[model samples]
Target: MTIAPSDSALAPALRGYADHKPDHLARLHKIEGQVRGLTRMVDDDRYCIDVLTQITAATHALQEVALGLLDDHIRHCVQEAVRADQDTGETKYAELTIALRRALRL
Candidate 1:
């Protein structure tokens, strides 16, 4: 199969999630608050361990968001694309493997 630089079919199809953007925004806002709290902890001369703990929590929160987004992509974007064209299963599988590798690196 010819590997195009872009998945034109999936790109347009995946943009149909306008119904639940508020949920994503809410998660982002929570993460934002966590970051702000971390900043304040540093500014207030909090203990090193306390600051590190908050940092870990914020990192985990970010990871959770990333995982959620990835799951959505797999369930919706990749699922639809593969269903639309059965031959794309290999290409989509490769893409998921690459994404999983990057996530693992973090």
Candidate 2:
């Protein structure tokens, strides 16, 4: 099957994914606030363990956001590629593998 990059079939789904930007930004804002709180915790000489725990929670929250985006990309872009009878699954898999490796620092 010949694949054309200009596939209109995927546009709507991609747009839907783009529409998620604002919500993602809002989540980042909250995460930013958590970071600021963490800074203050350090300045106030809060318990070391408590500060560490907050850092862990913040890391997890950020990971959750990243995972959400990855899932959306797979559902939209990757799925569209597959339906287009292109080797989109393998392409997306490789892209995601690289992304995961970078994000996880592995």
Candidate 3:
């Protein structure tokens, strides 16, 4: 159930800025390795508790990445929208609400 951004009159508040820094990329790569390790754990019939712990760590890492991106969005895009008197800020807020709901599987 992918939720794409609506193409309304409001300009998109989320724009592609600079690419991820080397450190960020390295962190993501490590997370990817962790995910692969989980797959290997399942294949090797590892204990359930161990797998669950790895999953918890992976979830935290992903959440950290998300929060960083959200902070950037609030600082740059959302702030600009509010200053320009554009509808983008409200739309962005709604988008954030939907994203949180989806992320939490609520």
Per-candidate TM vs. native? 0.80, 0.73, 0.69
lDDT of 1 by residue, 34-103 (tens): 9999999999999999999999998998898778778877887678778888768667777777778899
Pick the lDDT winner. 1
lDDT per model, in order?
A: 0.78, 0.77, 0.73
- For model 2, residues 1-106, the per-residue Cα lDDT tens digits are 2334444665564442585788778888999999999999999999999999999988988987888788777777778767876566766566766767777871
Ranking under TM-score, best-scoring first?
Answer: 1, 2, 3
Global Cα lDDT for candidate 1? 0.78
Candidate 2, which ten residues in sequence have the lowest lDDT sum?
1-10
What are the clash counts of all predictions, listed in order? 0, 0, 0
The best candidate in terms of TM-score: 1
